[model samples]
Target: MHLLRIALASLANRRFTALLTVFAIALSVCLLLAVERVRHEARASFASTISGTDLIVGARAGSLNLLLYSVFRIGNATNNIRWTSYEQLAAHRQVKWAIPISLGDSHRGYRVLGTSQGYFEHYRYARSQPLRLREGRPFAADPFEVVLGAEVAEALHYRLGDDLVLAHGVASISLLKHDDKPFRVVGVLARTGTPVDRTLHISLAGMQALHVDWQGGMPARGAARVSAEQARAMDLQPEQITAVLLGLHSKIATFSLQREINEYRGEPLLAILPGVALQELWSLMGTAEQALFVVSLFVVLTGLIGMLTAILTSLNERRREMAILRSVGARPWHIAGLLVLEALALALAGALLGLALLYLGIAAAQGPVQAHYGLYLALTVPTLYEWTLLGAILAAALLMGGVPAWRAYRQSLADGLSIRL
Candidate 1:
């Protein structure tokens, strides 16, 4: 108890340097924890983005490529699967339900997804969390009605019944606009913190309506243009679709169904288990993840070095103080213990402060992060791994404490009592 008081009093005397050391450690700890938390949450979010689906079937292409374009909206599909194939797969006896996704157009900057009501009923995220409407309802049977994702509605400031035109391509700036066939916002979906948050959903017929006047990806010059009213009467069946997400009747039949689809004689196709493809995608990202972790670890090491430097520097000024303690019957080992305690104290303070900063940061930036990056950061308690990290840091701090403690222990009373004698 007495030694603790002495340590506290000594730190209070050099509070400026002590506080600075604490602040540095705190910031570093914050960065480390932030990296870890964000990494874990990102993986969780990505993995859960399209769960409950047994397979994602697309035109024969690399599994990673198909997953990227269909799920993450990260790239363009090499080729779209035929609408006939999607129909066949959806009608398969072993299939529980299938959702068709036809991607090509864009509303402002958000991807326009052409899907059926089955998407609302079957598509899920974050482990069976179904899509729900925050305002209005899902797009009705009308071909011109559209549903906006939470981000799309908030960003474009669209309300129910507001009409908006979509661009033909995914580019931010495109000359081809579907102005002749504007879609009215019928619904706004609640935020899912997935790619769905940035999407604009429309019926497959609505998608076909936009391109009805076009041939070979352009408006036919001499061809008659169909108005919205006329498009309602025209055939709106899509000839091709980007991908299909399927649920299976039995988990045991997943591999057999996948093989059957891949071996289909009509057209070359690939049926991939979502979890397996997701793992492949994550494997490709492993290098980047490791890079982030290494950078954060280095940052923490720098902070610990700074604390060590501050303690060692203070030791030189405290030699006389140590000699006085020795004269007062304090053993050299006691002086060492005091130094160790101070280091541990700084580490402990920094760790607690870092946790405060982490949660505060998460709370403050949660909305913006989700809005811009589609990353939903939840403020939660530290995990066991996180606790382990804190423990490792404290252990490192103790080891670092030994350095200055040893210096103080080895110093003779003469070094403190005699100055330049």
Candidate 2:
């Protein structure tokens, strides 16, 4: 305990350099912990995006590609599934429910998803949490009515009864505007921290109405246009849809249904298990995660190296102090112990400060991150792996301190006596 006090007092005397060293390590530790936390939480958020769905059936393309466009809204679908196929599958005896998704439209960079009221009834996310409207009701009889996600409304500063125009493409600003077929915001959904939060929902009939004058992805020259009111009187059944989310009546039927869908004679379609696709996506991303982990580890190593440098450099200035201690009957091992304890102290302080920094960052950014990116960063206690990481950092610091400690220990009484300063 006396030696520990001596070590503390010595560090306190050089608080400036000690503080710098501690801060360096603390920042490194903070980055490492933050990366791990984000990686874990991101996977959890992605996996929970759409739950309780047995399959995501779409036009035959790469499974990852379909998952990306359908769930994450990262890319576009290669082709669309015919609406007839979606209807047939939805009416299947083994299928409990089906939610059709129509993409390829955008409102201020947010993807527009055209679906039925069954979306709110059957779609689930984050542990089977059902979608709920924060205000107003779902689209009713009006073909021009729209529902806004929490993020979309908040980002665009929209409210119930606000009129908005959707673009023909996914770009934030497009020349192909559907201004004539403006939609009134009827409902704003509660935030779910998923892709749903970044989406705008409208009835499937509403989607067909917007494109009544377009042919082959472009407005036909001199084509007679159907006004929003006239669109209601016309057939609005969609010829094609982007994808269909399926819920099975029985879990045992998943494989059989998947095979049946894959082998359908009418058109080529693919049925993917969300969980499997997610796992595969993560597996493909493992290399990038490893790269990030490696970079953070190097940052930590650099900080430890800085601490080692500071301690060793201070050794020259402390020679007289060491001589005085020797004259006062301090042994060589005592000097070594003091140096080792100082390194351990600095590392322990850094680890604690790093933890504090992490929580502070999370608290500061949690709201905005969820609001903008639809990522919910949970503020939970550190996992066992994190504790292990802290322990490893401390252990590495001790090993690094050995170099200065050995130099201090090897100083003989004669060497202390020879100190002229």
Candidate 3:
């Protein structure tokens, strides 16, 4: 207990220097933990995007873009596939089911995904987890019912049986609307913290019905608006759609099915494996990710370097104190133990403080970050990598602490209680 008290008193003597060391380490821990969290979540979210789905088919363009737009709702489609192409692909023997997605619309800031009932049943995300409606139920065959994503419902404060007018384009003001036919909100999905949380889902028939009277993307330019009763009589056949999400008959047939899909000649279309396409996207951003990781490593190095500087600079002033301790029947090893204990305390305190900050950051940014980027930050216990990271930090602290201990040991041997200032 006496020796422990000695360690505390020594550290308290240089409170400013000790605090600086702890602050530097805390910042380094923050950087290191952030890098670890992002890397782990990126891979996890990417892989879990389309677990049960096997293939994504769309008009000829970059497969990566098609995957991003159709699965992530990230960008607008470059081109639309003919409706005939969707029917032809859906007829394949290897395909268990297929869901057509029509884009080019939004409600407020949320993307509008016009799909079929199959989408609600077959669509999966976050580890083969099927979509579960949180409130009310899925949209009906009725042309005016809408099923909103979790985020859309919570953000817009809509409940079942509410009314929503689809925007003409992806903007709030697109000079177009199905003003004559507003959709009734029938469902609200549970938050999955994925892109699905931001999408407003509606039946493809509803989308086609909404724009039946408009010709060539304009509102018929002052033509008579058709009533909802008249729209039911008209053919709501969609000529084109943005993409098709697919399910395979069997997991083993995925590669073979992908090969067949790419060679499909019904129209100029491309088939992509969502997982593979995600890797392509990540590879594009890999350089930036690598740079971030390198920067974090340097931050950790900076912290260790600061500890070394603080100790070496304080060694001269501490030399007399070391000699007094040696005269009081203290062994060189005892002085060394004191340095080690101080280093351990500083490292642990900084780590705890930094971890607390990380938790707070995650909580504060959880909603906005997920809404904008579709990336969820979890604040659970540290993973194995983080434990290893902490170990490395503690190891560095010990190494720097040894410098002061070694200096004091040699000084005490030569100047035993002699004040040779």
Candidate 4:
């Protein structure tokens, strides 16, 4: 107890240096916490996108490519599966449900997905979760009606019943337009923190109706356009679709179902286990994740080293003070305790301050992340991993400061009361 008091008193005498060390540690802690948050939330967002669905089927291609197009709206499919292929597998006895996704267009920057109401029923993201309607109901027999994801609605400032037209592929504007087609917002889905948040969902028939007059990729650039009424009557045959989401009747059938679809010679196609494909994607992405971790480690090390250097450099300036303390009853052990206590105190103060900074940063960026990044960073209670990270930081601080503490102990024992300052 006496040694603790001496340590506290010693730190109080050098309050400026102590505070500087604490703040430096605090800054590093903030960065470490931030990286962990981003990594955790990213994994959560990816896992949530196809929670209920067991498999994702698409034209034969890499599993990662299929996931990116079918679930993430990241890139277009290299080739679309035939409607016959999707229908054949969707009708399989082992299949519980199927949701077909037709992709080829966008509205402004938001990807457009042509699907059926079955999507609202079978498609799950995050953790086998159902779609939650933030406003309005799912499409009720309205052909040109569309539902906006939370991010889409917010970014585009769309409200219920707002009319919008498709932007050819991803182009915001083009020389030609589906002059005959437009859709109105019938519903708005709540945030899912997935690619769904960046998509505009409409019926498959709507996709067909929009391109009915255009025989190929585009209509004659300066040519005559058809009327919306006429498009409503035209045959909107969805000859092909980008991919189909699969739900198995039995969980055990996943492997057999995947095998069946892959071996089916009806047409070239692929079936991907959503979970396995997800793992593969993460593995491919593992390098980037590891790199981020390494950077965070360096950030922490730099801060700890800086604190150590500052205190050690200042230790030389305090030789006279140490000699005076030696003249008093303070022993070498007492001087060592004081240095160690100063380091611990700085670490504790920095940890608390860093937590505050983390909260403020998350709160400030939450809305923007939800809107632009299609990610919801709810300030849920901290995880055990985060506690572990903080513990490690404090451990590093102790080890770093121990070097200076040992040096001071040696000097105090040597100088005693008779030595020169």
TM-score of 1: 0.91
Off by over 4 Å in 4: 220-226, 234-237, 356-384, 412-421
Best by lDDT: 2
Per-residue alpha-carbon lDDT of candidate 3 for residues 1-421, written as tens digits (9 for 90 to 100): 7877987788898899999898888888987997789787877777777778888888889887898889888778888999988988899888889999999888887889999999989988877878888998888868788999888898899988889888877876666667778889999987777888889998888888878777788775454777788887878879989999899889899888778778777667788888888788888888888888889989988887787788778777777787788778889888887777777778877787778888888999878766555468987998888989888888888887888778766664576455556
Error of 3 at 283 (Å): 2.3
lDDT (C-alpha, whole model) for all candidates: 0.90, 0.91, 0.83, 0.82
lDDT per residue (tens digit) for residues 347-398 in model 2: 9999999999999999999998875655777899999999999999999999
**Which candidate do you rate higher for TM-score, 2 or 3?**
2
TM-score of each: 0.91, 0.90, 0.83, 0.88
For lDDT, candidate 1 versus 3, the one ahead is: 1
Q: lDDT per residue, candidate 1, 228-315, as tens digits?
A: 8999998999999999999999999999999999999989999999888887788889999999999999999999999999999887
- Can you tell me which runs of candidate 3 are displaced by over 4 Å? 1-31, 221-224, 302-306, 309-317, 328-345, 348-384, 409-421
Error of 2 at 200 (Å): 2.1
What 10-residue stretch in candidate 3 is worst by lDDT? Answer: 411-420
Model 1 misplaced regions, further than 4 Å: 360-381, 416-421
**How do the residues 135-218 of candidate 4 rate in per-residue lDDT, one tens digit apiece?**
998876556889999988988899998888887777666555554577889999988777888889989988877776576687
Q: Residue 256 error for model 3, in Å?
A: 1.3
Clashes per model (N, Cα, C within 3 A): 0, 0, 0, 6
